[model samples]
Target: MVRPPHLFAALARGWLAVAVCVVSADLAFCQGADTDSSSGTVVKAENREVSARFTPMRGQWKPASFGGDGPVSIKKTESGDELIEMLAGDPITGILWEGDFPKENYEIRLEARRVEGFDFFAAVTFPVADEHCSFVLGGWGGGMVGISSIDGNDASSNETTQYKEFETNRWYKIRVRVDEMAVTCWLDDVEYAVVPRGEHELSIRIEMDPCLPLGIANFMTHSELRKIEMRKLNVESGSTDPAAVKVESKTEQAN
Candidate 1:
């Protein structure tokens, strides 16, 4: 059998191209398997190991109490997404979850939108060990975002203070991760803030104490909350020291 020289060269080039593509795809898949695209955290689970579990605190939230002079209801959007709507009114208006929730080494995620009013649309207060902290979004006149009452300083004056433009009626994804080393937050899947656990005490303001452990409150802002979830992170055993826990505000501390 006789074959043309050019045809043999062309077939060799085609085989080389296919080899290159296979190697490139394998490298990309290996990289993606070890990292989370949304949060930029490394995945610890192997092929046979089970991934970290996510516990649903509220896919559809029911309020323990609805404060303020407005209204709260579970409504479906035009796009068929279910959400809890809080109408604007008093100083605080929203739902509160009084049930038991994880206090450490966990992450909380939710979708929130400011439908009306001029204040914050999401003020999520959760426990950090024995203490508590609040992640405020679209707060302080709808531009400020930060954690409240770090070392007796409010979110506006704290080190995690940031300003972001939040549009009305537009949904934004918010996530917060609390661990022994630091408290990190992401807004719309972008890294927003990181507050390290150092000498500074982590505690909620006195006003936020009523919604302690786990709660969501809005200040004079009509908002909608949906897809609320909490996931426990796999922490190294014996990593937390109970004696190192600091309680800053005795008046607001949960009993």
Candidate 2:
């Protein structure tokens, strides 16, 4: 049962070498998890930096252009930013962005503030490929965020539904990006919802069709919108580019 001193030393060294190897392997595995395998780059989803370009759409919007039973007004603020307001009264009152809108792979951003009322302040209807969808902000008594009519269900009944407190008279920056894989939304630069694009059918409700192509509406609420901009996203680079084409604004009377 007695081993030579040299044999004992050899066994100890062997165990030490195995321990070193195990520790090295674990460190390597942990490092790999923080990297993007395909790109061989460090992955940083927490605060990913984005580079993007934006091009301004021409023609100042006129109140007469955006027709609805409720009052719609477009005024230039003291700071020279265009402000689009919809007064609360009718069930639905909105103003369509009268310009050519991209079908998909783009991000739309704007600043919205609830001036009055208790319902949704900004319901943005946009295009998702051939179909259409709406980003309902401050809905269901003013604290819901989600996409409408995913798989024939309204935003309140869909998987992307989320609730966040929204204060009236305070501006919030809202952004929505639609790509081939998913539709992601951010409020004040914080992510709010990520709806995967797959078997689900994306469509706007019948009442929202009037504001389609691209539009902002209020549901029995008074809302103000400004700094409305849209940029085409470059999928591979994860950046955005200014749209090249510019179209004249058109007026469509509300039905």
Candidate 3:
């Protein structure tokens, strides 16, 4: 006896259903692959790499005291680079700036969103005689910008310029520019701080004995990083637009 065509059709349908379920599970796994930084205006991380433009600085490692471990989550995309979370002792990773840079003015821009936790930190540095000059933006229940200098001897000189409040687990756009005699930072197009460079000349150089890596650190107990970007500015052309600056000073204290 031969089976009816309708019975064969029903069997085929059952097999098709199973195939569909398998494909769906595979796609979900791919989407969940370790990646963050989606928006182009932010830090481009798609596949497994991060996109950053600098004077093309290098990396130098420094011992950190935070009692935790974090991973540098990166992804590759069709157009640019992307990053998910950079954690050293916290959730996000630490950016280490250790390189030899020519004394010239430059601009830096990037986007960052807080996913979890209450605080995050990122900075740029110029090392001098075991001491380095830097600008740091930190957020803990809020956000702040400051200037600091660390000597190779482990001594630090620091000051806070802007302390503004920000929502936890949210994305904030940021821009920092360093010119010949001044430095400025912005949070979501808002002007936060402007400091005169004074007599300190920015220097970034690495020697065969020890290489320095230009760095940015995301310091948070538990947080997610959406994007990160870096660009060298043209000081002579004055690429900054004062008219577009926005200042929000609603400081949120750490809980």
1-255, model 3: which lDDT tens digit per residue? 101111001123434321111022122211221212221111112112322244312133343322444655545445444444555453445544334443444455555655555554455454333334455555443465555531221112233345656665566676665554355555676555454444343332221012133455555534443344444433323322211112111232122
Record all residue pairs in model 1 with backbone atoms less than 3 Å apart, i.e. clashing: none
lDDT of 1 by residue, 79-175 (tens): 6656788888577776777556677877888999999888899988878778888989988889998888788888888767889899999999988
lDDT of each prediction vs. the true structure? 0.66, 0.67, 0.40
| lDDT value, residue 209 of candidate 1 | 65
| Candidate 2 local distance difference test against the native | 0.67
Please, what are the lDDT tens digits per residue for candidate 2 over residues 125-147? Answer: 88888888898999998898888
Could you give the candidate ranking by TM-score, starting with the highest?
2, 1, 3
Q: In terms of TM-score, which candidate is stronger, 1 or 2?
A: 2
Ranking by lDDT: 2, 1, 3
Task: List residue ranges in candidate 1 displaced over 4 A.
Answer: 1-50, 64-69, 75-82, 237-255
TM-score of each: 0.70, 0.71, 0.49
- Hey, what RMSD does candidate 3 come out at? 22.0
Candidate 1 C-alpha error for residue 85, in Å: 0.7
Counting only residues 3 or more apart in sequence or on different chains, how many pairs clash (N, Cα, C under 3 Å) in candidate 2? Answer: 0
